[model samples]
Target: METTATIRGEIVTFLQNRSMTINQFARISGINSGTLSNILNGHRPMSMHQLDRITDGMGLEEGYFYDLYIPECIFHTTPDWRRLGPFLLRCAELGKLGCLHRAARMTLENISYAPMLFDMAEALFNEDKHEAAALLYESVAECEKFQYSERLALCQYRLFVIGLGENQDENLQAAVYFEPYIDRLDDMYQLDAYVKLINVNISLQRWDKIVALGKRMGHKAKIHYQQNRYRFRTYEYPRKSVIFYILYSYLIQASMHQEQGDYDNAFYYVSLYEHPDWINKPNEEELLIIEQFKDWAEANRYMYGLMSGQPNALNQYVDYVDSREDEIFLALCNIMIAANRYQLHIDHILDRYKEHLVFKTQQNQLGKISDLVTLNRYTRLLAELGIYYLNSKQFDRGLAYILDSLEYSIRTKSDNGMLRCMGIFEQFRHFSSEETQRRYTELIQDVQKLSVYAWSPQV
Candidate 1:
């Protein structure tokens, strides 16, 4: 039997076996008759104190009713967080995430408990219960609405970071969440917020916005550094160097152009980061990251040359990327290299990584937000496999894979993936039958509509 049902049944049986009328039991338990009657009839739920009174009145142990009632009330009751906070902390410590989530949901409207709730949420987040922590943080944010407090900004920042591994919708929501607080943020948080916003713009293919924001961030960081130079010299440089944000902004702009397949523009943005004076200012770790990004941009530039049929470019780039361990960029290099090798090589590579790719794709799809890079990777893989099949004259299989790729790309708002699939469809149009060509034409039209709608003012 269910725990609640068993408890309810046991309570009724205890009253019956004791030969107690409702009024007598109510008086003994110090509960009103109607409340007792309602509880017995299952028309209302019992509170913690009411259950305790019943247990005590029946000469049972002090905590017998508490054990039965708490689990039920944790989810259903309007929380008195003063009473519930300790219980929730215990639940989190004990790894009872289900109970923790229940308590968080119940406590959403407890505005007075926002500080304690934020603390608990932070604890949960630190414990890697991201979804539960996000729920609690959201509750705190809602309860503390219209306040320009640090706590509220922290909540939005947490949501933004968590949303990065989710989907486009989550990224968009995170962007919106941080919008109002951008100007009020401290220097560090302001830079972080702009970086996250740039990421969202990249996923949405908002190239103009990415460039504009990048410039704005750069200008702001420059002014901030100029204003704070005296303080930095006096205090021995406690915070992050202002040059870090400026370099990061340049890297984001470079990535924006790279995503749009504009290698010249991408290289120009990378050149901004490579300026000698700016390059010399970064600390060790920051310099290492910057070097990694520079290498990535150079590798992508090589890939573009190979894709454009430049002689020996594939072999040269493959040799350069062969010794690298960065998984995502390495995967991109390997995929392109395999395409250059042979159809069988491409098939073998796809087969090897197929399960991992599908699992990641499904996980992202099931999440509240999708991972932008993973979605792009999965979609590209499908398109590549489709192209290979088409080249091998497997018309039906190729069409199925390409169409599926387009659907997935559109669903996730992956502009890169959609564009890739469209290119494949156009390149292979002559190989498909007339009816299939018509279908491909319709799909292209739909993709166009989706692109328009995505950027539309009404949307």
Candidate 2:
């Protein structure tokens, strides 16, 4: 019953070199002397906790024995979840991805372990250890690739969310990849998935895609709401209330229509979400959602009227949004777009909210949903302001705004935003000073470099 020679020999050598007794080492490592004796004699398996303490007592670097522990303690025999689970969790916490991958791959050799890995991945995901979680999720997903299971769909969904970031092109790819699996997900998740997909599409300014997704989301939400309204309603629900999705679907559709310049249709969809009287026995949560949407509808009505060239709409929209500080940023963005479109001057309005024009994320009831959408609108606002100033023949101010827009586009990796900025700068290049022109060239070069890097093949 000799211990695995490699790890045991290392420990023996360390003790010999330091003239340390087993009892001394045990005292230092906080392990019971008998347990250490058993571990050294191969009478007991070395748990991850014991291994960590042993490594520390030897004055070695953290996780120094992890690679050795895998074969000596884990893969040398059948992998036990009691040992493997805590081991993987420790790996995630310590950012020991190499060891995590090695252990995970060994355990996943049997597809029966997929569920265990998947559950651990979910735990890691909730703990915000995304990279480690992604490894498990990918491993589990690959194991279940040919199967049409809800777990597989959930893995894909997790991967989709993990993959999303500042890169617009990458976000679109993730959305497209996760789209088909949406139907395979349980009812609770599909609405949130649709909402996330729609947000990505909104950043890309894919109005048609948003419209299509919104319709599907609305339909699914309506069906679920009706089917479950009279039931006990004890089951787990989506992040938002059920009716929130339906109302959100309508709100998004109206916004998409507004973006497309179909003001009449936009107003029609706005009205659909405005009242929401069809909600059966509305709870406090549902009532809050309805109220929020109503406020949005009211503001949007002013936005639509202003965008469609109604003379009186500008003052009213400004007054409404001014009273609601949370709405100021997005409301001003819409106002600028309208002013640019209709050749209306908003100098007074801009001066009034000049302090609010900076890019800080505004919090809303629905987490993360408004952050990205607000960012997209803010970027567009920058470009619109540039255009407005240029049209007014304010060369320095106009180029300043344009440069800011280009910088933000580059930061966000928004290809569409970058292109728009490039086009706008090119249109006004003749009016730009030498300093502004040089800055523009530098930004364009950065864009080109990013483009090349994005298209480069991974080794």
Candidate 3:
């Protein structure tokens, strides 16, 4: 919702902060003073060339001014889809979500452009420009009144998929948006929607809902498989889509049981996925997916074992997946194993994986990773590392990790994660030196002020 005037004002403030006058800035930027004054005073629009020169004059990075100027450009430009569409697409190609957001806000009153916006949104989504796509989709959804229109449904579905690994609230919103259209969707879309809803419920720890949905999905998959089997060749009854839904259902049930501390049921559900009959039934692609699911489920089972203090769980888990090459999965498994074993050698392990973790955390903050599950895992890993370092008496390093995690959690609007990090700070405060305690107390207060989510310890 920012305007050209706001951007110019920011530039003016930036120059003033550096104790530079507009004339000095214009001189250094190689721009005419009159033109600079006109642009600054809102009498003239700043060209990209002028903005770039000004950025250079201020010692800012390339594209710094361009990024700021994109909103102004889009806002002032006429609303012809033919002209605006390519410009928006170019911004997306350049990974400028801010520009897309600004354009969406600017075009909010122009519903006639919603179709073109939807197309551009899809293009952005296809290019993995999720935040940009989400912004446009949101605009489209608003224009469509979030009705059962195909575009609305598609927007809701994309938003749901994108939020799956990144934002629980977005996931919840997408789930609500898709609710009325679930029955009207085709089989594949319906199953996909159910899978996403189940994942969202899992992140929210809505166990009862997970169980209900899981059972329903299981039933649907069973019927789907049976009907297709009678109409098709051997092992082709359940297509890969149906197989995925069934596997995901099993995974959800396993997770739900694990959360409830029912390891037996958790193991039972995982066994269903690994059972010989189910294993022998999948097609090639389905088999690969099933194998991945098995590995993931096995990791969860091992995690449960470690949490429950079962003997040799860490060693068993290490021996099981020691050869795996998936960096994120291995990093997570290693951290959990180290934490469970009370290994104070967390510093070396963190040093080894910190960059990757930080990158993923940043991606989550930037809305690059839409999978809430993955985002949560990465956040939890950082928090656990923070806690481990604190327990190891490495206060500074621990605080750094905790603060980093807190920042990411806040950016993602993750109440659970923010509260967890805050709790860590509180616990650390009680055991720290006076100076450290004061710093931690201040941090705790800041976190409390920033946490807008309504959360209670009982919840």
Candidate 4:
């Protein structure tokens, strides 16, 4: 006779319809009879676990009771973090995103819940539960939108990182959205944020943005380093050593300048990172950072020389990169570019490192290389190879490599990469076979579809 449209009423109706007793339902649900009685009679709030059990006992899909439970158990009463926190976590664990979103939305009405939600989001993010954490981060950010708190900035930062993926456009958008919040974060966070921001922009080939951000990061890191040099605060530190940021800033500045074909300025910045003689007493970690930067500097020195058409630098660059597994792909890429530009014969060099020409993941002492960085380099590598072969009058190899790059470009939604591939293919259309032309046509259609997809409003 319970006519109310509530979870307990639904349970009552179900039991009556099946002619099942409370004890029978308890046995089926594996919940204690006494506990089940309290849950049904509204004497006690049901936990997510018990609700799931009851749902299963009712022969309903998992989370069948989540919608009712939210309004009835959570929204109808004062929100308690003790109960709400576990429920949200369980929802995440069960992949019940709709319920999690609803519960978070309801709970965040009180701005006091923002801190708790942020803390929960941090926990979820650390646990690598990114999708669930993103919901909480979005909710918390909305709740704290009017505030200029570091927590708000942190949320934006986390969202930026979580949002990064194969889609270059979305990654760029995420970076732009989060860039304004960088100054609001603490110094340590700013350093880490700049590095991540730079990495994404690098993937997108935004050299100008990288140079600007790198300068800011370098200034902030230098300030922090000067202030904290003698102080001993082991508890607080950046994601990397402070020295890493300083050197990385110089490295990126040099890289951007080099990309812009300013080899003189590039070499100037390169010298700054290569020499760390200013450090009074370098530790093991600091020494390691210095060594790494020195290696990078050496390779880059040769690259700058070779890129500026220094004939002797080519052999040195090849010799250096040949011994380093991590350096091989990028070195080969730049070498190919140089070879094409200078009309240098590097057929032997190509034959030597041909095995490493494909896209792959790599790990170093730092960690797994950024997928964004890897993908960007791989696409560019393919395009460069295509251009190299085409310029060498190897038409079939050239078209095949170009088409492969174009396909990857479409898959990753890299507009610049796609355009580069398309332009390169069009330049040598007369050399393309019928099959190659067909593939190119199909890839162009895919690009058109991708453009439409990007512009279409999400439902």
Candidate 5:
């Protein structure tokens, strides 16, 4: 679209009318002398920042620029406000975002009615919109003032994205501008801001700075980032520069990719967000990434697990099931046994992942007996029951769990699983009386002497 060169140059003209010299004006207006000279001489860009500073340092209503030009050729002209909007909308539906953007930029540069100009810009935005959404977004800002600051700033922030291209730099500026209204902004928008800030700083290669900024931003930045750590393993960035894009680009990319079910890139970009730069920044949309990853992983694992069971890859799938199912089972056992829900947890273990339970039918668990699956579901249940007894202040019962878990863990050579048993062993000693602890400890060394396993059925 068109740059605001005329409006910017106008600011230089406004400054020139003042009696202050270049040095004096620079000092008073707090604008850079170099920039001011360029603006006055028509050699530089005029920015909204310049307009704002000029408005503040000088007594100009900012609307004065609008009034100076009688017809107000700032955004759109032709008084075709009504038709162009709908016409532009039609063009956009037919795939003409660029045309819409040009028309909108022209409107902003030509029209006196600021809202009309915004409409024209929005029109351009709506046309063949995806490529130029950011441009349209930036066009939302109007030179005219809105009475409510929050509404005005939000409008401006959106327009800033459109006009400037949604790159990190532009979004960062937008974020800072809307910062005062930050507390009142929605959580998703806040996350967008923090993500933009982090991304901009990273592109600038200011990681060291992000370390502190991340902490300062708090949960708005971190919750999703941290939770997705495990989920991102499947994602691959493939390159570096792909990490940073303007706000418009990021949104467009995210929206378009979502339709394709292509999550790797989205997750990768979010991983960049999870870095020291964005971690802990609290924002509402924060959960979107993690939730998305969880959904993806859950679906992927199930699909892969099913495929893994094919005769073509049964052994491989068995290995796959071995690696994951055991860990999940152990964690479940730990959580449920500690909570005294062993029976309920047992049903969960059996109903789900039953195919992965490779043991035979004779070992006793869940009201049945199983004989062959040596280190299978039955053994785990036994271990968990021991843990439940232990967790419930029953040292003898806890010792029984450790011993059962030990038997299974030993047969399986699951060192990790053994570590869990050792943990309970320590818990028993910590909670039990010294005399009882010593006896259980001795029993642990000689499991054959235990009375519970010495059961002789009287039929």
Candidate 6:
């Protein structure tokens, strides 16, 4: 066996096993990032100092370096993922959904241009959730709207997804493409069309139009009430869709203030939208988001501390947030997560956001409409617990969470949660009791089946 190869492999595996990146490790150990990478990859032999750095950084005794980095190729090079698992798991622990999503996305597509797109996506996603290439969504839309060229629709979708800059060449080009088809999309997707139009107006920096579309979409239910529904009536909407729209408007308003560097007012509006309104408090489906919110708030607080010259360490954010009252801290924590989810979604947390478990027995306990929101919240929590369990890969535990999500979905009038709730139930059906699996299969697309599961309006 190649002794050099074995030593290099061992060193790489050891460093990675500690969950430190080359950049992070290099910084910690007074080594150069590129040089460290080269050494780990076997291009450079370990210098005594470099070995010292690795060993010191790892908090291990001297032989640790030789143990890991000796013997020609005796170390089977760890698979790339074998090294990556630590980074990804660390990201998950930090509740850095963006980090986790970026890493997962990186691992997913092993194609040319994938790296560039993934890098750009990570930066954009971190700064703004709407930042995505959306090649997939655009392609799908083009196929759907073949009659009118899909370029504009695709552009509209992209602008909406990224949600920034009006005069930029790319954004303007997207706006130019979508401008022609603007008047034509009126009745097509109804409220969704209105939402898209508002998004397009935002790209063009036509705040007047953006505001007008918002008003119209807000009143759409009153103006366009269906035979109690739509052409896509099968698509259930959240009862709080208007509230959702309002929140979106305010977020954009907050972003505008933030851009102006008016931290006071920007944060004021952010707090307005972010405050835990009884009406808007997240139900159980969003518990991961809620938890992640705490993590990010802790992270942000830590970052702020570093900016203010505090020691650079993990619990930096947590320590700062703790200085604030627990209630204020929790509220801020929730806000961080909601701020991202408001525009687009990141994946690691998508399933957490989509937890679909229900408790038939507990749901039966919620017999009143007056209790709907509270009960829905409870059931949603149960669903999230399922999601938490499932994410842990405890198959049995996840199944139970899915059952709770389903019960909530069936009990609530919220069509918005359906996509999440139904989705989880569908996934769980295969693993659940045959009776639930059979019933859910029958109830699959039938919205009415939800009536029994949902709260009675009269109650």
Lowest summed lDDT across 10 adjacent residues in model 3 is found at 361-370
Best of the two (3, 5) by lDDT: 3
Q: Which residue ranges in model 5 land beyond 4 Å of their true spot?
A: 1-80, 90-139, 142-148, 155-188, 219-459
What is candidate 5's lDDT per residue for 275-376, written digit by digit as tens? 324324423333444343333333333323332232323233334434453344433333343235322223444456545333343311112211222234
Structure candidate 2, residue pairs in collision: none
lDDT of 5 at 20: 60
lDDT of 3 at 100: 62
lDDT of 2 by residue, 1-459 (tens): 555557777998888999999999999999999999998888889888898899898889888888787888888866788888999998999899999988898888888889899999999999999999999998999889999999999999999999988777788889999999999999988998898889888888888889899899999999998888876556565888889889888888888777778888998998899988898888887788888888988998998899889999999999898778788888888888888888998899999999888988786544444466777878888999999999999978988898899998998888778888899888888888899989998998999999899899999
Cα RMSD (angstroms) for every candidate in the order listed = 9.2, 2.6, 10.5, 2.3, 24.8, 27.2
Model 6 TM-score? 0.25
Give me the runs in candidate 3 sitting further than 4 Å from their true place.
Answer: 1-152, 159-171, 229-240, 276-281, 297-301, 327-370, 389-401, 430-459
Candidate 1 lDDT by residue in tens digits, 180-236: 676666665677577667767766767787888888888898787677644523332
Q: Write the per-residue lDDT of candidate 6 for residues 1-459, one digit (tens) a residue.
A: 634445456557766788767898788878899998887776755544566577677677643444333222112332244333443333433345454454444444343333343344344444444423343233334334545633445345444535433223343455456545544443334455455556545534465556666656645534443333222333434333334444445555654554454556655655545542523344543343334333433444444333333344324443454444322322232333332323222233334323222222221111221232234445545555556555556667666556555645544434545567677766655567776566556555455655454456654
For each candidate in the order shown, give its overall lDDT on alpha carbons: 0.66, 0.87, 0.67, 0.88, 0.45, 0.47
Mark the regions of model 6 whose C-alpha exceeds 4 Å error after superposition: 1-383, 434-447, 450-459
How displaced is residue 25 in candidate 1, in Å? 19
Show model 2 residue runs off by greater than 4 Å: 1-5, 232-236, 365-368, 455-459
The residue-by-residue lDDT of candidate 3 on 240-279, one tens digit each, is 4466667777877887787777889989988887653644
lDDT of 1 at 2: 48
lDDT of 5: 0.45
| Ranking of models by TM-score | 2, 4, 1, 3, 5, 6
Over the full model, what C-alpha lDDT does candidate 6 score relative to the true structure?
A: 0.47
